[model samples]
Target: MARTSTKRLIAQARRALAEGNRSYALMLLREAHDGAPKDGAAAVLLARVLLVQDHPMAAIEMLAAHLARNPRSAEAARKLSDILASVTPVTFSRVDAAGLAAALRLDRVTADPLARAAGLLLAERGEAPAFTRGTDESALLIALLEAAPVREPGLELWLTARRRTALESLAGPAAEQDEALLAAMARQTWLNEGVWPVAEAERKAVDRLDPADPAHCRAAALYLPAERWCPGRDGGSDGMPKALAGLAGDIRRERHEMARADADLGPDISAADGTGDAVAAQYEANPYPRWGWVQPPLAGAVRAFLDRIAGGSGGPQPDGGWAGGPLRILIAGCGTGRQAVEAALAYAPNARLLAFDFSRASLRYAAMKARRHRLDAIRFRQADILDLPDFEPPFDRPVDLIECIGVLHHMADPFAGWRILLDRLRPGGLMYVGLYSASARRGLTALRERIAGERLAGAGIDPADTGAIREIRARLLARPEDDFERALAESADFYTLSEVRDLLFHAHERPLTLEAIGAFLEGEGLDFLHMDVRPHIAEPFAASVEGGHGESAVLDLKAWAAFERDNPDTFDGMYLFWVRKPG
Candidate 1:
């Protein structure tokens, strides 16, 4: 075959592969191989194609041929080694026995199969295996003895019995050995195979240690699952500590109830008023009131969005690259100030950051973290996002970024709040706004509201009391069938994907479609640079014919007819939009 033909065929195969036509690419590679039987390049391409198709053995054979021809090909050798390590079980052999022994002696090959095999091979070569001071040579040897099938029957039987006897002996007098080794062995067993029995045995041995022994508690804690310490209240089973056992069942029950109440539409029965509608009332009664933010995921999403925009070419230009000076940033509804502090530390190390939230308690917690880390750049303030008393732009040279994630959905008029934010953005500045998507969450909202009302009416206890809260949570959990209905009812409000579009872009009464969103950006002095649907909004649920769904089709449809008419772009569920003012 001509060299030019081989090159053309390889290029064609690469293009097909890039386009995800793997089968077609493989056919081309096979044809090329037929034409150029001894061509090393053809063999290499065939090997790569086979590897992608998961025929590792075929890849190995092809790569081996290629390597034979090109002995100096480190890339080919590395690829061959990786495939071999992944597929072929590492076995002890005389060829590399000394190297393995040295690694084992240094404790570098502990627990890994290839390393263990090498060590065993070295030991078998009549060389005294060098044992590291704190290394577990006995355990390594026992594992290798078990893995390698002995050709000599008598020798095999003796080795097998010795391995078992070694484990038994070490396990029998567990109190005499280091607690760390016992815990490590237990962890290894658990990782290799979910052998809870081994872990349980190890835990029992550690528990037998005297209370005064420092290692005793550490060993027990190491063996204990994290869930045992902080078990989620929702139906998860984890044994609690004796000191916390009394509260465990109650906490679990409370968690169950809270989950249900969170799902329902009614007021939380645990609140001072005994209504499950605290969230609804909090927003509905005072959309602009001081609100408390929780959950770092919510805050982090907003921060990421703003950072993306601010750093982009179309948005505000940084004064001196990212490190030239700190960019002034504000996190509205910055609960606990985690996102705010993170932003200060990440983007504008020298830049001033003001983290404002309505809850004094949350701010206090944020302050504690800031002080602990000795971060002097962040300033935590307790203030309402809706009615800012003295918020001026250009703290240094205009607020470069503003993050408002879940806050907009809670407001009575989110657009009003959005406009207020837009006015605050410095020219070429970026604002990250998240609101609920209507297309996805309307049905949920309706159901949640209905369930919350019923629960609140039935439960006569004060919402603020622990008992009342417990009762409310219990009621919600009792009817697991209506969990979604309850959640929608309790949450402040949800927007559909289309609703988010209309709220952010369209001022007209009629909602805009995908086409309209793009067109509107051109019409208004604003530019819709990018938009991202919230990740949680895409959660799959059972499909229904009632038009109500959890996933947003509006956002999913990337290209659609532009809105010819002035329509409202109303929807239910949360969405993030990055819009910019022309510089």
Candidate 2:
């Protein structure tokens, strides 16, 4: 079990692999991994060998066991995560959740099993009640809630029923006193913007309670912090029970801090009347996609990432300041600062980034996140995309890269905004753009039309009304599982107030087809270097092309368009691709 022996075994395994002796490599790697169970490198090597030998299940089990021992092993975790993500409908047992949490993006994990379990429990018990302590469902739900927003509609409905039961119990002496359950509810409601509908009777019961009462504040925590039931109770938490008051205080502190951050956001490029103002107002009210956690980036040079993605497709090479000094990056509409922080950290000590958006609330959220990450180099400013054409940066020179993802399609003129962003990019520099595909989002488009036509016919629903949004959500959720509109329930956005608004009730949205995108690229005279498609789409499309996975096939716009026509949902997320400006 000596460290030297493990290293020697690993070195021998590598030599065997290089010599075309896979069996020897596998045997040596297994011995090395068994000797040093916590050694991530040895476990990763063993797993790779297992995979190459057509033993995928063995590879997964080995990685899982390695993660259980050394949960912080990035090498083992990455390999496990890649395998898990490549396959669909991954079922995690109750025992597996805690061990896999370190490797998997738990928020994105399928909640269908949890929903089915809860449903079976409800059917047996006659109703959904307060989660009893020490139950499997309770522990699993709490872990998922804490990790990320739970996106499953069935789980949301089950929780809503349970929340109502807990609220009703608050009116009696033997109230819902489970602190862990209360905390989990608070986190879920806060993340979802209190999208759960409250029955009028339950609302009236909560209305009759005193705001100063400890139980009232506890019940109110299950709703959004801004709701009427919890108003003016800040600092009033003093002299109350510690567990009850702490949750309330935490919510108030977050809102207060966000307000302070809003005041501190530098620069102002606020636009008056038109599509820009309406869109700005929508985001200002509820910052889209309230993010909690950010994944740390692996540090590397900016050009290294470009080369990996570009694969030397042969375009004009970037020149000027980027070649020798800090790579300048402009992240237009960097909502909540997740993208900005990732970019800034990924190219640390070698990149200067400016991230801006029109909504002060969003910019404020992003700035606070950047500060939390200790990223001082990012210039977080408030600016509308329309105003960026006239805006000047503190640093001179066009940026080496411009990233405008999921932003331009909402504008009155997406092309004009794209043109403005392109002008800011240095010649031969790269641009990454993500635009909505009209073909891919046909179902969502129909749903949006239905909501506008049926729900908001004459009076028009206010985007900020939680009650109205909840009603609409309930109606959608009531649909059959096979219903096309019911598919919205599967989206993470459906669980959150702000995201649902952005997705289904946006003031302005225009989805484009690939044909239009190809034409725009032609007119703009930019080289289409790469389309960031996942392997499932990329592999099939590349095989269909004449050159078959060559540089020409990857860059073939017409082929890509035809592929999209055949497989419409290829870009359901967006048409995220990279292009280079002519030198």
Candidate 3:
């Protein structure tokens, strides 16, 4: 076949595969392979189609034949190895072992044969007995060891004894030559022990062994006593003691905070202002607050914003027929309860509001705020957002109003969590949620992440320790000139506006958009009453119009959008929407 014909056949096969015509694709690929038996690309494609069609043994056979003709072909070698590694035992046991032996004989089997053997062993253990020999013997042995049932006393004891002897031998004189092997042995032993403290101690001891000696570094890092040995820094291991102490302190502080009552609010309003003596006293009394972000002004602003959102100015108005009864609002992820307290005071004057957060220290502070205001309508609970069993049953009626701002974006699965919240809403209930928007700030975040990675690598900062965090924070807060550069470089799991739209509206089947409030009311049998663009900033401007302008112009646009989107009740910073279900 001509080169042009082969290319055309390959293109057609790819198009068929993309269009979900797998059988047609396989036919085209087979023709292409038949025309050019020596063509590595055609062989690889045929192998891929065979695998997709649930014929792993066939795929392996095709790849092996291609590699036999072109021994130096890296692509063919790679494809063949991958197919072998992934083949099921049912398929692998049926494979011509003699052919595989020939391939191994051609060159040293440096690639991971253990993974391949494991897959094969999973389907047929009878063929595994023959695998424990030759230069590639260890791979087969390890695979059989892993595949052997743990509950089988005979096999378990045999593998355990074999593993122990192998590890002990590695600990001998020649262990230095294969540090990775020695480390792997140590990790396996530690995992078998099932004791964290013992494992940690062993890891520490290993780190103290010797860096010039790779075996020690690997063993220490992988198992108990895994601390880096610094010969001159101190008689002790390098930075491990300090790191351990910091972790212990964090755990202890959290426990202490959880045990304390929420009566920290003093009669003196000055002390409650979160400044000067108050801040010092609070820190001394409760240490958990020291670990996280804290800005008194920002907290106050968040509270004020929540109040505006709940005041019925930008939210749905209660029907006169329903009477202004006690409204039940729930605030999920109510960190510090600042916004929760603000909502209670601003909107639910005669209603009951429940606010919950994961951090005991934050809940305590929020409880203090509620007490300070003498507000009886608000209640605070410390609870995980994902596991909200406590709030589910007693509050069986869907929440009348729920506010979750700057919370969903942090969750590992934002869309899933958002769906859970939506399920908890009353038929005519209102909800407000916020997420980090991808824009100028996202660019800054990526830059910061890169800088952090570089600093961690350069300083040899332990990834598990607070040292990296401290180093990054110091560089970020260094000078005005350094701040912008550092901020821009950092990366985080933030979403762009388009990503948010697809996630909430498209993927999860939730009704979300810039026009979510109105659309949900109309489509979901609710009332689309009002929307607020931002709640945190004094000035409001669309994200597209916010940057790259004079301060005067920025402020002017912000002022205009404040009224333009939803007048008199608009606040800038976070986008807010409110809708109500009709009774």
Candidate 4:
């Protein structure tokens, strides 16, 4: 029952399984399980062995037993859900389905988004989109949507922007007059895991709201947030339409109602004068990078990460910080707090998380979500990232990890902000950075230029004008100058009004090249840790790089530049990479 004994058992089990000795492996695994009865890793290993032996019923029973003990074990939950989902309809009995649903706890609003998606999908609940309507893969892909809310750390924000044209075909831009569709919109926003990006068919619906009739205000709750697509909604300096004014008031009230503290939704953070102020303002209005719950990584992926923060393998802590204490994590530019919440949930047992954004509205939404999920370790503040020197550090301790993704590129002088944060991170501490790629966005920028040239210089149809946007997308799709326009239509970012504007109308953005990234790394004196890339592409990249540039875990940006030249869409979530200051 000793910890060392359990480790030895696991090692023996893995070796036995590798040598085609299932019975020995099972015996060793059973010993490991008894040693740590609630260990999800033990359950996972045992299940893999059982499934290989065609004993799925035994596997399910084992996993369900572990899950009953460790309810929040993201690993046990995922294994159970995946097996339950994969069984043939005839073989999957009601008892099995109930077991899966119980693990998901579908009655709750914030279960693991993917698990919920898979459950609904396996249950044949939420209807499939037209593309997958008749295909056998329909269930699989629809189920993936549950897990796909935020594909990468920052993809939830920019993804929709790129897929605006394609998203129209998914679940948005419904008729305002259709009560059934409107109800679906409301359900999509609240009851569902993530926002569905609905579009109102009528632009004039905002003009028809009666200022005298309060009943008209009821529709304003869901309608106003979805109405962000409409143009001139924010241009109400004077003499705004009665219906528009009413809706605006309702939105303000709704945000206020959701506010957690007295000054929760106030402009404390946005009042700063910073390089990224303009970009911050845009997100203040419509927070980017939206996502919901996600199953944490598998236990085997990072054994220590399965529960608490552990000292990094990168060697001794450079700051010589205490080893046994919790990790220090900062979620810079934590919009609406999902990223921060994910961190809190993932590392709640052994980390202190501090999240701050320049948008109070975003923070308010994040606070509400954190409270709903009971993520208590995370602390939210209205401090600007630029004022890091001014904001009091929690515990007066240095940070071990900092995540600033899809934000720096928006700063007027992004590098300056980078320098400031770099100073705060302890030597050998890791930082996850996401920046726009120049090579990838080259064609995208050109397409945006042409789209702007056609529109009357910010006087185009309201973004709420889904019909008009669709017409524009259709026109571009029909007569695309090249593959870029077609790519936009097919992209996941082609969906919402906010997403469309983010892709095209971003006021301040500059793409970075891998060469530039290398230079930045050299200038910052940070070691490149890893670059997240598609394995399919990375496979050939590894081969090519080994032949020419040599192999390294840290990416070769010069080689990456060439790679992007050949595959421009490689950095859709931008170039997200990790780095650490020299230990």
Q: Which prediction has the highest TM-score against the true structure?
A: 2
**Residue 181 error, candidate 1, Å:** 23
Ranking by TM-score: 2, 4, 1, 3
What's the true lDDT of residue 546 in model 4? 36
Q: Tens digits of per-residue lDDT for model 4 on 169-252?
A: 223454234232233233232222223333344324544554234334334333344334222334442533333443345445
C-alpha lDDT of all candidate models, in order: 0.45, 0.71, 0.47, 0.58
Q: Sorted on lDDT, highest at the top, how do the candidates line up?
A: 2, 4, 3, 1
Per-model TM values vs. the true structure: 0.39, 0.85, 0.36, 0.64
- CA RMSD of each candidate after superposition: 18.0, 4.6, 24.1, 9.9
Residues 473-523 of candidate 1 have per-residue lDDT tens digits of 334334555665334323221111111122221211222244434454465
Off by over 4 Å in 2: 10-29, 38-89, 93-95, 101-132, 135-137, 173-176, 226-236, 239-241, 244-260, 297-302, 308-325, 389-394, 456-459, 545-549
Error of 4 at 480 (Å): 8.5
Count of clashes, each model: 64, 0, 27, 19
Native-to-model Cα distance after best TM-score fit, residue 319 in candidate 3, in Å: 7.0
lDDT (C-alpha) at residue 174 in model 3: 60
In Å, residue 195's CA in model 2 sits off its true spot by 2.2
Candidate 1 runs further than 4 Å off: 1-316, 322-325, 348-350, 391-397, 455-469, 475-524, 533-573
- Top candidate (lDDT): 2
